[model samples]
Target: MVISEADHARVTVAVMEAERHTAGEIVTAVAEKSDSYHDAALHWAVLAMLGVPAVLAWRPELAPRIWEGLVESWSPQPAGAPLLVALVGSVLVFLLFRLLFTWQPLRMAMTPGATKTRRVRRQALALFRVGAERRTRGRTGVLIYLSLAEHRAEIIADAAIHDKVPEDVWGEAMAALLGPVRDGRAGDGLVAAIAQVGAVLAEHFPRGENDVNELPDRLIEP
Candidate 1:
């Protein structure tokens, strides 16, 4: 495919921006670009290498005799040796490509920007469940949960709020539910917080019946 000069320049800028955010060296950015190119090269090389062997093995004049002799020479000990070898070799090539061309550079490229760091903290608060627990490290918090559908992790707070919570008693609860002012079990913590916050806002400035009735129209509008 033809890549326009403008597009190439844009990509180069993006790569540089990513490096700057992550605090990566100039050589690291260049190496990342080179590794991406190398990954494409290695992918094509492996396909060509395997295709050559496959084509030779499938030739009409030689294939039948070769198959017959191979079957006769095989023992009951292990039937998948060749297939296993090919699979293992393919895996090794892929791993090598990842090691040499992708991992380090991509990591450098992913160095968190300030905006990204802020977003992570917001997500932690958003996903906090009522009884969810938290563990802090440096500038981030680990929010843990045990729900069936949404069991995983989230990064919450930052160094700024690390000591803001009075004690560890409700840290998990706050981490799970975002605000200590809200109540209920961990699983329902977020819902409770939203309801409480909404209620507080509604009490101060209640919506009239006419405004509430207009909700259907607002929702249905294209």
Candidate 2:
């Protein structure tokens, strides 16, 4: 779901077009994912591993069956054969769970939506600070951030714009941005979002005579 070169060009053009009528500097950014979320996967794997022993303990007969199946040889084994089998089985169970979590899709599935949302918001703010806020002359920079893996969109506007425009005012733009993302048309979504944002900014902050293009129109693909 990563944005391609063509998508980058489309978004850049959108930003350029949108900025023409407004003083707001619109920056678009797309990320593969907000976070690695490895910790969540590890927690899930540990829970699954722990369940193996609990299940075996509850179903005492199944433990003996597993032990017999593992040692079919008629050789005289120790009296603690069942306990040893349980220990080896538990180790194998833990390894299997850990290996399963190595798959990216499974690991992502184990992560909660709330965690993804928080991470996306954090990345968006960080990008805004670096890519738009510092670069814009009037402190009217806005960041349209998308996290493809998490299917989340975030809008981070600088203090100047945010002070006047309520947070809910950007809901329409955010919805437009996420609409295409939901359907795998990320480029189209970004363009639509830019247009919506431009309309809002144009109403509030029309381009001034000495207005300069303070920020680059290129897409920030971090």
Candidate 3:
């Protein structure tokens, strides 16, 4: 779900206030989802297709005639009957699962945490490159990216700050960011995260006389 207009305004103000204390450029971006995760969806579909045959083989009673012909008659079934049933059932199962997974909530739930994390990180880094990286006069740009569907966030810093700051240093900010997000308070999470990040930047790259607001203070919704 998209944040309210007030939340958008709050985010913009947070960025501006944060930037006031540090020369670092802070760009905030929120996305309903980072990636379609189509590959993961396809993988689950394929697994479902493959599983149908195994289930049929294990429980012949589910499709008895196809496996061993009529029980009373005891006739030998056509060798191809089971195979055909399996093929058709597999295709049907695959299609059913694929259709069900098209629903966003189910797909998001079924997706592995690692996959979501990787996709969020990848998207966040790309956004950082385009929106924040090296765009500042001091090469101290920071991007706080949040993926609502994935329930994950990424904090990417420009080269200067990245080189100086330990990656784990953002843990506190990320933690602060997600607590409110878990409660469906994404805007609050973002504001809190940006504040923490700003504190860090102010400490490392304190405001200078020649500091410039190199980036727009807006919440990018993409």
Best by TM-score: 3
Candidate 3 lDDT by residue in tens digits, 195-214 = 99999999998999888788
- Local distance difference test, candidate 2: 0.85
lDDT of 1 by residue, 1-222 (tens): 122344335433433332232211111000101112343445544664575346545663444444445556554425544454445545666566456545544433343344334444344454442212232122222232122112222323233233543334334533544332123233244333223323322333343433311101000000
What's model 1's TM-score?
Answer: 0.21
Better of 1 and 3 by lDDT: 3
lDDT of 1 at 178: 36
lDDT of each: 0.33, 0.85, 0.89
lDDT by residue for model 2 (20-111), tens: 99998888888988888888877877787677777877886776677667677576567776667667777787788788888889888879
TM value for model 3: 0.92
TM-score of each: 0.21, 0.91, 0.92
What's the CA error at residue 172 for candidate 2, in Å? 0.8
